[model samples]
Target: MRPTGVQPIPLASALGRIGLAGSGIRADLPLVSGITLDSRSVQHGDVYAALQGGTRHGADFAAAAVRSGAVAILTDEAGAELYAQAPAAAGSDVPVVVVPDPRRAVGPLAGVIFGTTDRDGAAPALFGVTGTNGKTTTTYFLDALLEALGRSTGLIGTIEIRAGREAIPSALTTPESPQVHSLLALMHERGIDAASMEVSSHALEFGRVDGVRFEVAGFTNLTQDHLDLHGTMEDYFAAKATLFTPERCRRAVVLVDDPWGRRLAAAAEVPVLRLRTEPADEGDDVADWTVADVEPSGLGHSFALVGVSGERLVLRCGLPGGFNVSNAALATIMVLASGVRLDELQHALDRHDPFTTEVPGRMQLVGEEPASIVDFAHNPDALERTLASVRRPGGRVISVFGATGQRDESKRAVMGAVGARLSDILIVTDDDPHDEDDAVIRRAVRQGAEAAVQEEELACEVLEIFPRGAAIDRAVARATPADTVIVAGRGHEVWQEVRGVDVPLDDRVELRAALTRYGFSVLSAPRIES
Candidate 1:
């Protein structure tokens, strides 16, 4: 048995059940001390899980783990066999637990050791937001709102993981179960009152979020994404729905603007707060919250929020784009439903300033001569919406986008089509060609753009630039004062993943250099969309 707190029993019990060639191990045998998957992070008394990978097996590092003071090992049967054959020093005094499937057990074991599930129910309220595109935006908006209301909050998302003053670079959109619980425990200890997290479908399907409870769950509209991993839209939707199920969350706040969200709202077991932007149709049932008389202007949007009690509140947002209005409304309703006082909402809204700052890569504008916009729009729907938003009078739209390698190749053409139909000039370039040929991915995106232009009967010039930086620079140099440049895909990512390695790249820095080279001044005013 592992020492209490040094390693929790749930993880210990799972480890103990593995038939090792040993007698009754003491509950405090001091065999295991900690758990880790990253070999570099292995510490004394840690059990390093050696998982099988595309190129190598974790068992190959058993000696290294043992040298780092790991008392036991948890791996699959093959790994166990390999461990059994190792030299006496490598296998000496260390127990090897042979689990049939080690990956599935990583989360549960992590939960037992570092998780806070056994703590009193006084854990801070947690809210989970999941969707393909708007998850990061909504999470940030929620964090801002919570913080404005004088609540100490923690945030976990694709951008970064912020807990009080400590900010760790995010490794995944959602952390693995052990890290998740460990972070939650840290937050709880630091006097955090609430937490807002972006839950990815991959996290749900892989049990990365197991042993964590959510007080409220939010859903934004879903579009084409991650089909390569999920295999089908149905499977993707099922994975997203897992967040709202009884096992994951206790209450649900769903946006009914998308058909899938409407369906999920109907299927959720917990209390559902249905939100919609458009008017209810004749056959449409009443929703918990509805927006009406939406007024969008250059300044921002002002709308009326009607609740189930027929109570109305005049709300104004400092964010542009019609989609942002919907996002803010959904977040507002979610915060309200979480038991925050309605009176406090006015102060929160008064202090709410969406345009004062912007999400790094989303709708970031560079250069003044021929304005350049950088956004993270890879899918057809997101690309279409973003292009439409940048359309201005007396200005032509120049689009620069590309598809990622090893992802759903089917969407390449769709993105291309949207760009060709909306842009005056199209530049197809590399996004992330992880382990795949960059040229192959660029061609796919170009094909999609060409097809869209043909279908729409529009004549647009399409250019292919292999290296993204050169393409963006050429587009910027060629643009006149009356043109707008849009750089799509890979928003807020600090590194570009190519051939299985992450290369340092920042879109904002590159765009600035391109603008300076073209003798154009960057805009100083804040023009960010949430």
Candidate 2:
């Protein structure tokens, strides 16, 4: 939903500012109060963006949008033609602003309509973190860090959007450009000084974050995923690199652990502070910030952030896994690059334990007896890291996971291979098989596990289970006190899509109930609101 306190702008002035004007209408006729791409979400005085889609043109629903109170139409040449032929346009005089590319124009239109683009010290300092795995966790950590520094913060990510303490559940990692701007405006209205946002490659490629420039953009790492949308690794990396451009952000804090991060550090258009969260090779260039002296602390680890000039800040993460260290280090460096003094950050770190903030679904703990956990490790790299981190000294790792249907089919087998290599028992199950056959999806995953087991002669037990709830039950029931049960792929996701229907499924709830039924002691309910 859009904010309520927006100042309406005349349609002619808004169009002229963006260099686009409507046809067959008076300049002073319509006043623009808000902008939205969805015809169903149209409000009075809103500009309905009717762009062409893959299969159907959005203009097909212009009648609905107009009825819902859209005063103007924004579309491409093709959409304009279709809207003109629509029955709703038979005698209608609604202005149609046709552009060469309407998707790109939506961001600027929303920006002008929402007053977010030309902020006069009102917009929150936007911190954008982009990567395959750590975006959510890093953004959460950033929000906590900013709050510890006595700044009011907001968050926009896969889990939800927050303005002060109010939260709205999110459907995308980074929402459409209009919502992105509107949320920032809402945060400004609430006196939030800063906001941490998860910027996915899809958001960059689809123009979801076009009109916003970040104070500091962070890169976690690049890995194979979303090949269904982007066909190659280079294309995926290219989409992420767009966030580091001068038009998108002022400065960048890039993690140079993987080759992709190193490449981004060398190629970012904005000034960059290179951070190394992992060990560096002898020939690698010296990083601006490095993580050192990492030691196990409770469920997580404590580490030192050593700057190139010998400045250091020690911090601890309450989250499990070594990868969390990378996530925390990225958040710390991003805050430091934003001008927070080292001593101040260290004080905040010590006083508030900001790095130990609980991220809802990233390595979320549900039980301690069998060490049951849930994570959003749908990709190959994330699955490998998660599996390795959950393995105990004498405990067997029993993993239950599945690949998402119709998305990056190439990662399915690789994820399966990784799971088999790391987990002692891998159970292939169903994730969101949106419109694809569930059995077919499970077969691909199972085949990969079988192939890996046979080729490597690994002593791993591979099983196939259907209906994700039953899979979680089986994994937990089979586990002993010494085993670690991990349910991955669909963490924090509360529904599963089969064909066109959304079935209710929450991994944490299911895991918690199963653990209780198995007589295992589960952790208290997660305190962080989703």
Candidate 3:
């Protein structure tokens, strides 16, 4: 559903001096009620922005967008020239506006056409969470906690965008400027007083979150991933730092367990709430909020949240792992620092229990007998953490994972090495090999794993299997009742991309099927049959 809070601006009025030729063009130019770049999502009264892409030009799909009821077209000079030369439909003349840089104009034009001025008039409180990992989980926790505190909250992240019972599947980790404002407006109309969103580094760098005004910004420790896009670790970190600028957020909640987080806290202009799991060594003096005596059990964690004011708030988070305890403590401090009543703190944290249960694909366990975990741990840091989390006292750790095609090939070997050192048995498989040869990708990861074992002399067996379903089946069949099988990469994703085509595949489903085939009771499986 489109957000109604922003008044739709007339196409003619919004486009000041942009010339329109024929009367047909004027009549065709309906009010720009919405803006979208994708032809598939174009609706009546929407403007389609056509930009040149790497593989295909958006101008090629202009006809499709018009047919799908896009009222006007915004394109670069090349796209406008092409659209002008192309044949017009029988009774339609699509008005095309030729901007110098369609991408740059698309965002601001969306802001103007959508009437999203940043005038502060009691707008909903916005929270942004960013880092290499745990953004989705932390956002979910904040959303649930806020809602439980009698505040209607909207959530936008990797999994979904939810306001009340209405949910929209997310296309981007953070939506473009127009969609961001539009979603916020929808939440406002739904009586949502607050919103929590996952702000990705790419989204921040690309101006996808330009117009967002956040009250609280959060940091979940940074680690290696997305080096292919950013070109360097420094570049990746710079993008994340943009969210903590004074213009974007008023306060920051930083988890200083990682070196990057500590550095960011030191650099932030906004007041920071620092959370730590380990004992303070040399840096405890600078922390504003510190978590101490962290104890992680099967169900949750117990820790002490000590404020800089010397006030102690004991927090028992119903989220597994010590990492999650830091996440919860950071989130709790962020909300409390945002002016939440001290009396409401415990109740809000109590509500975090239910929130932790719904984090999709985050260490999600499946199967009854052998038991498997599906996590989005594609990088070395996350892989090591996942292995450490599920390490049973006397059980073996079987890991199934693969590197993505055409992205940070440098990390492939590192991931392999970490997997080899952590898991007793490692099964290398396919993970969104998008247009690249799957074997080549698997071999790169295998090389890393082999290097790790040879260099460190770790006693681990690494095996490569093609056709991801077969790999999952083999791993599940081989796992004993006491062993834990972790299926990493492509967590919660239903489609597997190969040669640009997305095929239907889900790891959890295949694992359950494999366990059932092996005579295991399916009653205790974590995933429900679809």
Candidate 4:
């Protein structure tokens, strides 16, 4: 639904544009400044949209919205009935416009209400990244590259929203439909010249990006995630595929790292530029962008970003893991594909890595002298890669991680096995055990870790600890001066989800406290800032 705002255009004019004017909408209905889905956030001259929610219809809150000064409402037939039936709304004069599906129209309607169209002047080139993982990191990379090119960048992702100089903590990987449009409009208002956003499968399938047109659409890689929401991997891929269509975006930069991506690149309707991370993916002529001459550095990996034109832009990657290298390369190619001048980016790089800027919680080194690292690697692929990347030169790898509750349970065992196989020590802990038995979750992970130790005939020690904080402490306390402690999952997040409530928890904070508890000195310079 819409959010609170000033009603600028006449409600009739907007409804007429969408051919909804005669459908119980008064021609002289109040002009709305903005739109909001939240009834609690309704303001004067606002159009509140009552949508079908998972638990309850938003129409149930229409009276409350009206009380908060909502002048009009857009809802489905069922919500309209409820609004009419409510005693408080029985005689309420607020005009209600009924539609078959409010979610699909919220973005478009919001665009009209907030003037997200060209009448306000051109909006910055919109770029977006979609994938199971790396969406946030890719957006960070894209925004940094854009800024280096002298563009006032706007970034919207899982961690935070950056509009010009303002940064706000994000509530969703992709915000609600109206919020997406409204935020873009606000970015335009703030004189942003370019924007990058992370598009989740849920956002694509749920109409969150309905009316938004991306200039450059990027795909990092697709993996098994949100199976409960999409029901199958094919369904998940299809939802992501929607973002690459000519209708949604004009140009596409797809990473052909996995089969899903290869398929997407082949099927995408727009002008496509495919990026490959494999140095041995033979037939270099088939790839548009390729990774070559990759080398492991002391802090991270460095690779040559080779474009189709046969020119290589080599840079050191400050972020860890091959996946990160792929993300960095994809970000560079995406920027260039967005029609950015290669010389500008090359000049911006000078000799530094695009990742010279800090990427919070993505291999964030919180302490040294028995190095402690915190990252947001929650899935099997991400966890495995992070552990492999942080393997000590002649030391051991200590991994502390857990599976998220109420998510793709199918991936839990795989994640456990990966951590167990890759790390010298695996400490299984809780990672957002929301509404699920924490013990059951822990047991499932330990079972997989133990199974991996048996099947692979590997010699990795595994431990299970209740509560995440104690797990962090135990992992760090057991490590020696030469060992590395890597805590995966929940990066840049200040809270942990437990039993439907958010408890204040930061992985970096916990890791640092654990290091202090182990008497580890801070005199050893932190390799990477959290």
Give lDDT per model, in order: 0.77, 0.89, 0.78, 0.83
Tell me the spans in candidate 3 whose CA falls farther than 4 Å from its real position: 4-6, 11-30, 89-94, 119-123, 281-285, 351-355, 367-371, 521-530
Ranking 1 against 2 by TM-score, winner = 2
RMSD of 3: 3.7
For model 4, residues 130-218, the per-residue Cα lDDT tens digits are: 99888888899888888877889998888888778788788898988778778777777777889999999999988888778898999
For candidate 1, give the lDDT of residue 63.
79
For model 2, name the residue pairs that clash: none
TM-score of 4: 0.95
Superposing all C-alpha atoms, what RMSD in Å does each candidate have to the true structure?
A: 4.0, 1.7, 3.7, 2.7
Model 3 reaches what TM-score against the true structure? 0.90
- The best candidate by TM-score is 2
Clashing pairs in 1: 413-448, 416-449
Candidate 2: residue 193 lDDT (0-100): 92
State the displacement of the C-alpha of residue 56, model 4, in Å, after optimal TM-score superposition.
1.2
* Full ranking by TM-score: 2, 4, 3, 1
C-alpha-based local distance difference test score of model 4: 0.83
If both were scored by lDDT, which would come out higher, candidate 3 or candidate 4? 4
Superior by TM-score: candidate 1 or candidate 3: 3
Which has the better lDDT: candidate 2, or candidate 4?
A: 2
Task: Please identify which of the two predictions, 1 or 2, would achieve the higher lDDT against the true structure.
Answer: 2
lDDT of 4 at 352: 47
Measured with C-alpha atoms, the lDDT of residue 306 in candidate 3 is 79
User: Would you estimate the TM-scores of all the predictions?
Assistant: 0.89, 0.97, 0.90, 0.95
